[model samples]
Every structure is written in C-alpha cells, then in structure tokens.
Target: MAGAQMVNSHPNVKKYLGFALLPQGGVSIGLLTIVAVQMTQLYPIIAAVIMLSVLVYETMGPVFAKYSLTKSDELYGLDKLNESMFEEDTEN
Candidate 1:
C-alpha cells in the first residue's frame, strides 16, 4: 500500500491508507512465514496469482478515491445557483 499512498492526491486518503497498512506489516510476516514453510508444496503459479491480486487491489483504491473526490466536488458545486438567494441586501 506504500505504492498507493505515494501516488494518492488526497492527504486523508494517504493517512488512512497508511494506518490501514500498519497492521498488515505484522500479518504479512506471519503469512509469508507460513508460505515459506510450505514453499516446496506450492505451485509457482500460486505465487504469481497472489502478487497479481495484491497489485490489482492496491491499484483500485487510488483510482476509486480519485473519482470519488471528483464526484464530491461536482455535488458540492451543485447548489451554486442558489447561493445568491441567501445573500443579505446591502443596497441603500
């Protein structure tokens, strides 16, 4: 997820993703250890599948966040036409 954080445009996205990844550090150690223990029994293709799935999942986060922010920006601007309706009159 370090790769995703590096390219994410939003600060919240990077910060949250960083926090989410912290626990994975320990989890990964255990997972890799298990995988290593069974290395001789595993097929080579399984390793490739694991790497590809992780890359795809990591890549989708930033892309989804980018589009989500873009959609939010659009929604935020939707009420601009009514902004003047609430303005106080300053005419003498």
Candidate 2:
C-alpha cells in the first residue's frame, strides 16, 4: 500500500497495485520444500496453510485482476470481444 501510494504520488507510471497481492506459488512452494526437509514438524501446518492460500489465491487472482481492470475501464478489448461474441451468437 505504501509503495503504491509512493508510486501514485511520484511522477511514475500508474499501476493497479492490487496486482501485488497476487500469489507467488513457485517461491512459496520452494521455501516450503526447504522447510519440509529441514524442519519436518512445522512443515505440515505451514504447508497446509500455504497450500490452501496458494490454491485460493490462484483461483481468485484472475477474478480480482479482471475486476480491477474492469473498474479502471482498461478492459476495452475484452469488452469488445465479448460484444462481438454475443452478437455472433445472437445472429446464429
């Protein structure tokens, strides 16, 4: 949030900042693997939570991104595509 604020305040290019909330499954899985190898006891609990988090995030990330883009009016091509598809379906 602070970083987004700083970017927005500064003369940098604007960004959707919400993208930062997206999950990093590869890195998390790698670290979790290390934990599993080194600290076997804590691995189960940590792995379960992290895996669940990753699953949820992965599932919802695209939805959130689409919502953000739609809210920002940046999905012009997608909107057009959907309209064209709808028109084609109706015509058929």
Candidate 3:
C-alpha cells in the first residue's frame, strides 16, 4: 500500500496503484524457505503460517486485481468475455 501511496500524487497514476498492492507469494515463500532452513526450531509453525498466507493470497489476489482493474476502467472487453462464457448457446 505504501507503494501505491507514493504514486498516488498523479491522477492517471492513481488508477494503477492497485497493481502495486498485488500479493507476491513467490518472494515470500522463497524467503520463508530460507528462514526455515536457517532456523529449524520454528520451521513447522512458520512454514504452516506462510503456506496458509500464500494460499489465501493466491485465491484472493485475482479478485482484488479484477476489482482494481474494474475500478480503474481498464478491463477493456474482459467483462464482456466473462459474461459470454456463462451464456448458454441457443443453437445447441
């Protein structure tokens, strides 16, 4: 969020601020792996927590990204595409 705030000064840039808030599980998981290897005592609990966090973030990240794009009006034709996917084919 701090990254977002830093770029929030510009009107156009503000719309893309959500991109900065997107979760990056790869980096977190990599660092967690290193920490777990270095400190074996806290490995189990810390690993569990980090895995859970990554799972939650991975699931919700797309939703947040889509919401941000929607709010910024940057989805283009994606909404239409999504809607079309759910529509039944009358000719079938």
Instruction: Tell me the TM-score of each prediction against the true structure.
Output: 0.33, 0.58, 0.60
Q: How close is candidate 1 to the true structure, as a TM-score?
A: 0.33
For residues 1-80, what per-residue lDDT tens digits would candidate 1 score against the true structure?
57756786456554444433332333444465677668846835555665665565566655655554454453344466
Q: Where does candidate 1 have its weakest 10-residue lDDT segment?
A: 19-28
Model 3's alpha-carbon lDDT is: 0.73
TM-score of 3: 0.60
Worst 10 residues of 2 by lDDT: 8-17
Instruction: Estimate candidate 1's alpha-carbon lDDT, on a 0 to 1 scale.
Output: 0.52
Query: Between the candidate structures 1 and 2, which one is better when assessed by TM-score?
Result: 2
Alpha carbon RMSD to native, model 3: 8.7
List clashing residue pairs in candidate 2: none
Write candidate 3's Cα lDDT for 1-88 as tens digits.
4555676654533766565356678987999979877989998889999999889888888887777666666566576776677674
Give all candidates' CA lDDT scores.
0.52, 0.73, 0.73
Answer with 2 or 3, whichever has the higher TM-score.
Answer: 3
